[model samples]
Target chain A: MTTKIIYLDHAASTPLDPAVKKEMDAIKTYANPSALHQLGLEAKEILNNSRSKIAEILNCKPEEIIFTSGGTESINLAIKGIAQNKGHIITSKIEHPAVLETCKFLEKNGFSVTYLDVDKDGLVNPKDIEKAITKETILISIMYANNEIGTIQPVKEIAKIAKKHNIPFHTDACQAGFLDLNINADLITLNGSKIYGPKGIGILYKKKSIQLEPLMHGGGQEFHLRSGTENLTNIVGFAKALELAQKEDNNKIIKLRDYFIEKVQKEIPRTFINGHKKERLPNNANISFLDVEGESILLYLDHKGILVSTGSACSSEKLEISHVLDAIGIKHDAAHGSIRFSLGKSTTKEELDYVVKELKQIIQSLRMLSPIHLNKEEIRK
Target chain B: MKIIGYKQDKAWLYSNKVKEHFFNPKNIFKSDQELEDYKNNADGIGQVGSPACGDVMEMFIKVKDGKIKECRWRTFGCASAIASTSILSEMVIGKTLAEAKKITPKDIVKALGGLPARKIHCSILGDQALRKAIENYEGKK
Candidate 1:
């Protein structure tokens, strides 16, 4: 008999919700929203309604929202659109590749970018953002929460500074939407897949009067800013997923996540937690096991029908230490041993129990083979 | 069985033995003295591949009146590499230098029951180190 797989890598992506799937199925048959016909009007109405629902969840106006492909596109549009408008940009080093790479691109294009460093907890100090701001700074983009470590940033405080400086602020809120909507951002980007919505659909919340040059030029659909035919089905599904995820009382998930963390800490010796102790996302528990490679642990767990992620998915191809771990100053030994366990709305106590049991066995087996680990008795002698 | 290009079906599989040695390797040795004392005083002294390439091993030897006396090793590599070093140290502890010189990488691989194809190099490294240490002892004489 095949063993059931326990998925603990929800931060990577989530299974589509049944309600979200139903909404997408209903909207799939609609014609293009930009077409000038009765069917097109129906599609347009669905698209507009989804936008309004997303905006309401974000505590912003419907007109402030623009649908894009996903987190990457939303980040690109926000960063690049603002870079095209003015001089310099300010961002943090712990941002996702979408924001970091976009900032690099802007830098290459003669737009200066100041990459502020985060604390050991993977949080950028708002005062650092304020101190880095110059008269030439046109925009300040920091992530709402880190995708790897799940440390929530002080976006509201940073936004206040950006407001005082008359600098537009953007936040990649892809990892924060499932938790809270205390954004207070001039521009915010959120992805559907991160919140169990459809992939390829996201919302970029651009406050009214924030002028952004269009990334694409064509049909003038999204306020002549992002020109394209609307992805009605995925957008509808995204909105439904967002609304459902936000409406639920997530304290239970948080409690279960803490329980798992407690179990792991108690069972596994020398396991170090890798993010902000309390201010981290409720679903995230990133830890580093001394003297064991994360890939080896991940593969061994995979063999036992359990799934987990390393610090960064990007390093899976090259088998190098994660950049996020490096940015947060995790040394080579601890960095190589890091694992990220991100719980989801569907994660249950039974799954957590099974994971803890299997993890103890796997860690013991792996540690036995590691050359770096010596017993306390041996070390003392 | 030949160590190189040996398929799992054609050769005996020894993954379980390799894993056993990897997890519970016996005769682990450490030193603060010169390399020669550890080499001449132990049962066997085996130096394997370089550590820079992620492969390294050192096995110690002690001989008394032409009879092998003691053996210990230190290895820095993957699970199979370290296991091969430990198994080779065990295989050569009681053998004279002449007999130990005849021990090939295949013999070490066979002594460990068997090794995977990618791990054949580790056994080869162990064999080369043991022979080099034997050569070093002979030159002293």
Candidate 2:
């Protein structure tokens, strides 16, 4: 038999819920949502119902929700859709590459982008957003919660500021769970895979009156915002997934996550917790062990059948210093050694306890072999 | 043989051999306090890369009869870098300095059963640092 696995990287994506899977299997409507026949009507109904349910979750109108491929597509549509390759945009240094790279791409093509600085806790100050705005500024995009460090940004306050300045605001809520229960932004991006729903499905919540140019041009679907054949099965799965997600006992997940972080801090020496102590995602605990490269820890954890992420999924394989860690102003050692342990509803206390036990031993062993010893004077030179 | 299959482990960008050396790296200085013991006894020392750039490596050696008798290293890099350095330590033993000089990143990659395409840079670290230490030793001559 294969080794029993423990998954702790929910921020990248979540396991599909059996309930959602059964829902997907039960819905056998395969016609194009735009077709006018019976199968098409059934597919259209599924699409409408899913959109309505997700709109309810976001407390917005059904017309505001537009289906897309996933978080990256949602982000691209939101950023580029608004900019149309012109005007000023303001974003943070710690945003997902989807948003940062999209903004950078816009920059090279005759648009100005102001990458707002964040505090040491990886939080962009709302006041900083206000200062960066100018007459040429057309939109501001900030993430709801950081995918790597798990620092929840002040979305509503920033949104209020953007509203006062008459600039459209967008926030990538891929890491923000169902019920959103927290952030409120004009354009919010939601990913299906991050919520235990099927992959290749996501939504862009554009508040009524916010106009965005269509990223995909085709048969005038999705209110002309995103045009493509609807992914009815995943859409239906996402609706159920969101409903189940908001109903989950988040307190249990938070308790388990805190227990895990506390155990690591207590057992490991010289371990630094990245991100804000509070005001972070209840399911995330990102920590850095001095002298223990995160990739090494990740592989060792994998050896023990425990899974984790060194940083965001996009940058993990590149083995580069995390920009999120860098934006948090952590020292070079702490930044390079950072690892993220994201909890999900399935995480258990027993698993966390086992992780801490194994982690303590692994860190102790690796430190002995690492060159970053206690002799700091030599390194400083 | 499989490191990528637990929810999202396909991102495990490491070969099995690389995993082996990383989990159990070979000869290395245990700690700064212990390295104090070897402060004056080592023949040559070379340091490369830096923590600021996310990787740094240091190699300490003992030369005997024109051969590398002992090769101990310490590095703050990704798992691939650590594994490559560990394998380098094992490969340089009993080899003359010129033979050790002939060891390249391709040799390290071959010995480690091939690192991930992106991690090939890590293999570069140990060989470069070893060559630098040999140069440092030659300068003293």
Candidate 3:
């Protein structure tokens, strides 16, 4: 018999909500939203309704919302669209690869980017944004909440500063859907996959006045900001998911998260939580176990049918350490030992209890074979 | 302080053999207290890697009559590195000092079934530490 898997990696991507799936299944996938025929017009109306619903939740005009593939594309349009040529952009070191690599790609062009340092809690200072701004600085990009550590940034204050300087501001709120929306940003990115919506669907909300050159040069859709045929079914699913997410009491899920964190802190010795204690996402629990490599723990946990994730270093192409952990000043060696356990609304207390039991045993056994655990005096600093 | 350098394919991230070693690593020194005692009693010791690259291995051994009687290792690394060190410790014991000295990274890779291409360097860690311990033992003699 196959072991039942308990998924705890919701921050990476959440499962499709049954409500969303139902709504998506009902959508007719025949007519393109752009087609001028009777069915196409009907599709256009459906698409418009979905946009209005999402706009209502985000408190933005429906016309201002630009549909894109996902967080990465939204971010590319937000950053690269504004700073495509010869200017400076300011962003934090702890941003997702979508935002960071977009800035990096801009760096390859004529533009320059300043990667601001985050505090130990993975927060970007608003003053740093003000200090970094110059006459040439065009946009300031930061995330509403980090994906790996789940530390929420000071988006409101940073947006205020950016407004004071009249520089366009963008925040990738890919992982911040369950929380309140940060409405201060000129450009905001929201992903469907992270919020129980279908993958390959995302939103970019622009405040009408913000000018962004189109990334894709086709069909002149999305008011010339983003081109191509709109994905209506996934968009409807995305809207339904967001509507469902906003209606649910996230404090209940937060309670589950807190209980787990409390249990981990109380029972697990020589372990520490990575993100800010209070100012973090309700679902995130990034913890570091001293001397126990996270990948080994991940494999062992997988064997026991408990799913979790390490940083992108282990999961991605590069063998490097996690940029977020490194930015937060975690020692490289200790950073390799970090695990992110993101809870979901569907997560139950019994599942968490089982995880805690297995975790305690795993840590004990792994430490038994750990050389660093054995020679902590000389190796640990 | 890294890259004992062995060829491995990208597809094989971990083998069942590697998992067996990692889940129940052999001849581990257990705690820092035990490691301290093992260090004090060891006839030879070897060290490699640094915290910068997210891996470091330190090994200790006891040699009697030109043969390795005990082998123990401490490491800060990923799954493959930890498993490699554990397997190397078991392989070295009951072998002549000269034979232990001859164990290459490739031998460790072969024994572990196989490791990922990027993680093949981790096997080098075990081989280097063993080589270091054997050299230290010979140097003392």
Q: Write the per-residue lDDT of candidate 1 for residues A58-113, one digit (tens) a residue.
A: 88888899999999999999988878744888998888889989889888888898
TM-score of 2: 0.90
The TM-scores that each candidate's chain B achieves against the reference are 0.76, 0.87, 0.87
Stretches > 4 Å off in candidate 3:
A1-3, A312-319, A373-381, B1-13, B29-41
Arrange candidates, best lDDT first.
Answer: 3, 2, 1
In order of DockQ, best first, we have 2, 3, 1
* lDDT score at residue A24, model 3, on the 0-100 scale: 92
lDDT at position A269, candidate 3: 85
For model 2, how many clashes?
1
Evaluation by TM-score, superior candidate among 1 and 2: 2
Off by over 4 Å in 1: A312-319, A374-381, B1-141
Worst 10 residues of 1 chain B by lDDT: B1-10
What's the TM-score, to 2 decimals, of chain B in model 3? 0.87
lDDT by residue for model 3 (A1-381), tens: 223567899998999999999999999757998989999999999999999998899888999899999999999999878975699999999999898888888888888899999998898988888999999999999999999999998788888999999999999999998878845899999999999999999999998999998889988988888888898899999999989887878788889999998898788888888889889999999988887778877877776677899973643233477899889887766777789999998898888887888888888777766656423332223
The C-alpha TM-scores of every prediction are 0.77, 0.90, 0.92
Candidate 1 vs 3: which has more TM-score: 3
**Ten contiguous residues minimizing lDDT sum, candidate 1 chain A:** A372-381
lDDT winner between candidates 1 and 2 = 2
